[model samples]
Target: MTNKKRLELTWIGKDKRPKLEPRILLEDVARSYHAKHLVTDNDIFDNRLIFGDNLLALKALEQEFSGKVKCVYIDPPFNTQQAFEHYDDGLEHSIWLGLIRDRIDIIRNLISEDGTLFVHIDDNELGYLIVLLDEIFGRQNRITVVSFKQGAATGHKAINPGVVSTSNFIVLYAKNKTLWKPNRVFTARNKRDTRYGQFIDNFDAPYAQWRFITLTQAFARSLNLPIRGLKKAVGDSYEALLSDFVVANAPRVVRLARPDYDAVSGDARSMIDASHKTSEILRLEREEFSDMFFVAGERILFYSDKLKLIDGKYVAGEPLTTIWDDLLSNNIHNEGGIEFPKGKKPEALIKRCFELATIDGDLVLDSFAGSGTTGAVAHKMGRRWIMVELGEHCHTHIIPRLQKVIDGEDKGGVTEATGWKGGGGFRYYRIAPSLLDKDKWGNWVISKEYNAAQLTEALCKLEGFTYAPSDTLYWQQGHSTERDFIYITTQTLGADQLHALSEDVGTERSLLVLCSAFRGNPERFTNLTVKRIPSTVLSKCEWRHDDYSLILQNLPMAQREEETLKKKKSAHPSLFDNQDA
Candidate 1:
């Protein structure tokens, strides 16, 4: 279906906005809800993760958090035939598309102007997914498809199976391509003797034989440098030279090389005199080594242009890339042994993401939040993070792993890999109920725990208001610019209350007094936008009726040229899933 049609199906007219109801029991609905924490008053720039169907969570977030996210990385299910076990995957093709598209549309709204979204998928639906993303994020915002190696080797199959295995594609889309900058992975210069030392003979001729040999030998001997380098060349002769120099420099040795030689003569005495400049020789070697040798570290330490040292702090260097192969993924895999089903993402990958996306104190978010990788990395890197998970494994697997990170218990891998000192902690939270049910007249009657005030607060949340008072008193709407003094009171509003509210509102701003019953004709008050209670507040909520999912499911077949065109229009057209629906 066209994007225009999708928008037409989802858009709600302003006049169709729902009214409040008095009999509706919004309390019971609120009570059934549960949450470990609420970020209601906290600063949002700090990281946050909302746990629920990404669709509902996105909608819930849209009102207050539009255009706020910086970078979003989602490793969504590839929709391959492989069993996910938990999620429903057997739905019609159009249903899956509709589901994914709905969430993508919402996700597009949440990205900040400079933000980018990375969608991970396999070859199966990559093309279809790209087209869908283009439709939502705009063709102009599309970025590169980064190929990530998934497997090391391909198992033997009948037809020429000697190739390296598969790779997953990361389809990146930016809110605005002009404002997006892809993070770069750090690169190291080849320092291995096998790879680079062979090029040593390629040095300039003037510096290769005499200058190189004499300077290198003298410096190496004075510094007591490893003899291994010189062992290959002038072996016995080089040691004899070192013995001569050591004895000549020794305090007790006198007339060792030449006796009866004038101190100022242009003979071997002059050579011995110049050779006594030991500090100068050592200085030249130290300078050369510092310029040539490179050490592999988490942060790239390179030669700086500045020669002066101010307070021993080195000036900042250019930022590094995110592609980190320094720590071998195989080493981590061998140690961990893939005991957990979801398994742990490499600490190097996690650290790389953290270094690119945030700084010390910035918040990182991971909604998939398996095993608390984001939280653990963020804590070690001195960044804050919020993680969300929807399985029992959160407590059993994720929490314990994160605890190890905080207490510095699991020290070997991440610490050695990223040079991270483990510290910091986080409070966990679950999404809670936002509304209650109703009886008949939509009356705001308390059934169990929540009262009329609590129901009103829930209504405010449902209506996209960020703040709700517990007293059910008149307070200006916190989020909306047009509306002020939104109230949710079941008690009948008397003339006294209205007059008092009017007095409090004064002539400065218009008042939106919402109550179960107004004592007088609301039309008579020209300034008040009074709303009566016991009306449908969630009139815009509706089940998706479109067949977009079927289209998505059958995309692979449709894209294949060999497929029969006759099946193009069928509801479940894919040849892969041709069995009974």
Candidate 2:
């Protein structure tokens, strides 16, 4: 045996990856508002609307959401070498690849073992993205590439040198091939097509045909059974066998045989096996065995076991194929009340993704939540969701759109189809300030903007623990495990305080205390461990002053110029610029 060879995509800067900060989310209650029409009986405050660089947002979500999100649908900037009103769509090829690679790495970590990712893209980067996804999600894990018709061919086709683009693609991949289970999607049959019955009908209305065993020589001899409606023919040949049935004009019965079994012994077994094998070979040449059935003086037909009779009609449906053109891709501009004419995806498209990959209450994430389409669709479908965006549209477009969804005032883009008379709400969060910064003496210290609660949560995330404080135990801030707890404080700890903390922890439990300073014996307690803040966490992550627009600004100068032009034309010069300020 030989080792299997693998293929990978390589770019100029493929090896260089960004060192992202593991920041914390801070819910700004003043900016977070809910609709009055929202139902008061349910808990709808858990949905998250994060405003920050998606890379940092994804990193912040790592501790709480790793291997927990059931589905992730991202429509990143397509790098189409054009400027959009809300986003700068042009980028240097290498920079765009690196930016996507970093975010995709984190997305892979965020998805559950059985979860899947649906990445929407156009032809400009589909080939490159496929190789990139194969590297991250593995080649065998790819589910399928679905082609969606965006619109009719444009009139500019005559002037263009290439094919007129009328379709976009959504590529899907599973985190783990063995654990992923995609659900089937059923579409109603067109009334005109139903009348024709060109395909197999389901008792339900639409269905795909499946294979069934038909009469053959192997089936006839294995059970020594005779056809019920037809008399025995003189010869054992297929022509003679069918002649009896053709003359009778009645429903025929035949025995079904197990192809792999042996019933005869010695010479008789060899003779029967050879004869049956030849008959089977001849049967393989017939087309009706796989898909069709022939009836006297009638056209061929096909059906599976699922075929059913309802209301005097046979109804059937086919399995959904990779090519999807039935759903409406346009006319979704009024969805969420955000009229993003340039690149807004239809809610029906995202709805299909959710239907195929997730169930109700499962966590869904969208890093590039342009116009918040993914979030709105996920919300109406009863799934929990988190959306992150760095642009002002996070406020102007997404917030208002989601507000309308909650108030039941939005009546477009799958709202009526899903019967969404809105009820739930979402919490708005900003990425927390950096935890550590250099002081006047060039020594690292905790940022002054952090309050006590913010400090504890940031430290907990840095120390690899969940931030869940105990009500009775003030010192217990978080925990890595049931017995291993972590505590954070700015106060200095002396010998007595150390002894008391150790005693409180007891012999069975242990605590890691993080403070500004400590004065205790070197070998005093086995249940306690002390470490200084700022110094310990400084090395854990790359601390930076700005958390917003870092990923977008890091692109090449040409891309920055395009963004500047986009901002200037929109009369929003400060939109992408000075976001951190």
Candidate 3:
């Protein structure tokens, strides 16, 4: 057997991972919005809209949201080599890959075992993105690359010099392909199928007594038109009139085709053979399927079977394909009462993603939420969603757009299709300022931006505990489990204070205490493990680091850090070599 491995798309800083600060999220209740009352029983009001760097925002969400999100859709700013109003669309290729790689790593963690991810990009970095995602999501888990035709190459676009680029690509991957449940989505057609032109005049009659006639003659009779003068009477409207009639009388009008005898069941084959042998019009009834009718060794297929309910109308439909050209972004500039111009994705496009990957009340996440299209569409479709945006427009654009969606004032973009009467809400949050900051003395300290409660919550996250403070118990600021608890305070603790906390915790439970400073031999208090706050967490992460990025300039710094780690391991060999010991 040949040993094989996935090929990686390597670039600068691919190995150097960030010691990310899992900062806490602080809600801005004033910016949050909801309807006065519920529009429906299933309305969701707990969606999140985070206004901060998306990478950091995703980190803030992981502790609580990991393995929970059902679908993630990111329309990330790519290397377009052109600047837009709300985005820096161009970045160095290596840096872009690094940026995407960091976010993708966290995104995979957020995706549940049965969840999926979809990313929209053009051809420029499509090859690299595909390889990167394949390596991360596993080659076998990749679903498909959809060629989304956003616009037509007509009018001004047709006059362009080279092949006009009216379409980009959406790359899809599942967290675990085996566990994913794909909803069979279909594409709808506006008109009826012409093949179902034969009508059964005696459909209600018993077998061997049925009569057949042309559907056109039946339709003419229904319209009280003379069979010979049908074309002349309808004139230019003949096709439209006939199409409406066929759709209305779809069950009676059908096209007969020979069934594959080898593929059909024995009972159906018997009926088919009987119909051919005599003047018998045979029929077979199936509980899960429509009754099958045989006529001269052929199966009658009804036009109604091809119809699908699309946008409140039943029209002909086919299984959706990878090449999607129906979702057009035309005249949607004023949609959502704001404009991000080049960055705004079509609501229909996001709706398609949700329909494929989610059901009602599923959680959806979009980190690169330009114009909040994902949230807007998810709301209409009744899926709970969280959107993160680093741009100033998170307030200027997203909040206002969502308010309109909840208020029922926005009447465009999927509202009609989903029949949205609008009643859901979202809270506004910003990634709290990095936990630690430099002071006047040039020492790392907890920032003044954090109150006592905020600092306790932040330290809970850093210490790998859920931030669930108990109202009755002061020491139970958070907990990893019911038996394990943590307490945080800005005040220094003495032997007496430690004794009080230990007694409250009791021998049945354990508490990890974090404070400004602690005195005495804390090991004596069997259940308490006291440690200094800023000192204990100092070496755990890069303090005062508010932003995370992988840039070309940092390559040498990464090298130096790698060398330092290697030297430390060499000095203490057992620390690196023996894991179980």
Candidate 4:
């Protein structure tokens, strides 16, 4: 009999190798919501909530949204070594890195030139994640690290025995920092409180009583008047006389005012007198406050506090700093170190980021949308959004939450505190399946479930083509470039089928088709360029063989102590360095 140990070793070796086609990691089916006769319809709004793999969904979005998004906020899996209830939560550190690497690479491509990206992470992988972000987003594109309080309690046993809680990190990266800035709108309360201080607005001076001063010396100088011993003659009313003299000189000239306009409207005069009258007025002058004003001699007119009624100019203050003071952490109930549920995000967090980095009507995209928080907040802020989620939670949690927001029923600090009362709607979509599949001859054939036209549309979406022709039955999809049309075929096309496809492609123009065959006639289809399948589609999938596990396997076999030290060194070069190598 063969040795059992050798057989076990062979089995172990076989099991350790990666699979070619891994099982679908996160799968949740939903009914079709947008596609009508293979073209976008006006019935569907610009905003979207996609329930599917984020990577695949991003690929799908390439057709409609690449380089169009203005802001993106993603709180991806932080590889915290904790189990996740929704997915294969725990991955080897290297595997996690590889996964994030691919996803971030695609995300970087999706960002417009003026777009910004905000990523939330914990201490577990923050440094490594930063390095990865630098590699994908480029070091020059880094914005800032916004620190947020995660939890303030450390369960009585602190690592330092003094520090009680921990803070989370948000790493922001922009496509081009110099090209754009976030927009801010001041609140009416802040304006009234003057807590932001006395800054100029429209170059107008403050309308304080001191600014409208009545000078006795100036009055005496006017019309050769003398104020010598004026305290005896005019008494306390000397200043009032000066003011009345200035008012007579000024005369409240109404350049553009209607000739028939009346500032002495009976109702307005009564309201102003009633409101300004005080106990001091009653004590000083027995006459009512209304009767005290000598309207005939002085040009005194009651002015309401409303700025709209004034004829003054305003001056702008210093531009606001993009960083906001609000945090979204409150009552976040979860055991796996995840914040909120799979389909919920704190509104305050999104509001802060948007207010700092984007303007109204900017496009916001969140790929790993555990909850539809980003979309909801973007909607409330008057920005458009594209949300991608890859779990059943997208339907049960995200859809209902967004529906509540749309119907004005949600009050979870989002609608009530933020004052968001549903004004727009979103179109929902599920990631369409890949169009191409191998046949007996390893040849490309279109799937029967999809007609030629449907296959053409799917190919277009897969290959970054935004539109397809409805009138003609051209096998190729729309042009991304002048000579290229996104083309896809399920089975290998034979010589005759290739000729037919070429003839349909037309002789006048060349075709850049993405297919499963390169054996077509070069002379007849001289302008045609063929990109094979699997290569085109695999880039959009989380191919595990190309992921972190393979990277970790490259490391030489070493003792546990050495491996730990290596990881620590990689994680924190600032902490550990110059020790004996």
- Local distance difference test values of all predictions, in order: 0.49, 0.75, 0.88, 0.56
Candidate 1 lDDT tens digits, 422-479: 4544555444343444558965333344555666555566555655452443455433
Sorted by lDDT (best first), the order is 3, 2, 4, 1
In model 1, which range of ten residues has the least summed lDDT?
Answer: 192-201
Tell me the deviation in Å of residue 329 in model 4: 2.2
Question: What lDDT is obtained when candidate 4 is compared to the true structure?
Answer: 0.56
How many residue pairs clash (N, CA or C atoms closer than 3 angstroms) in each of the candidate models, in the order given?
36, 12, 0, 18
| Residue 548 Cα positional deviation in candidate 4, in Å, after optimal superposition | 11
Best by TM-score: 3
TM-scores vs. true structure, each candidate? 0.62, 0.74, 0.91, 0.58
Better of 2 and 3 by lDDT: 3
| Highest-scoring model, lDDT | 3
Q: What is the TM-score of candidate 2?
A: 0.74
Kindly provide the TM-score of model 4 when superposed on the true structure, using C-alpha atoms.
0.58
Better-scoring candidate (lDDT), 2 or 4: 2
Per-residue error for 265 in candidate 3, Å, reads 3.1
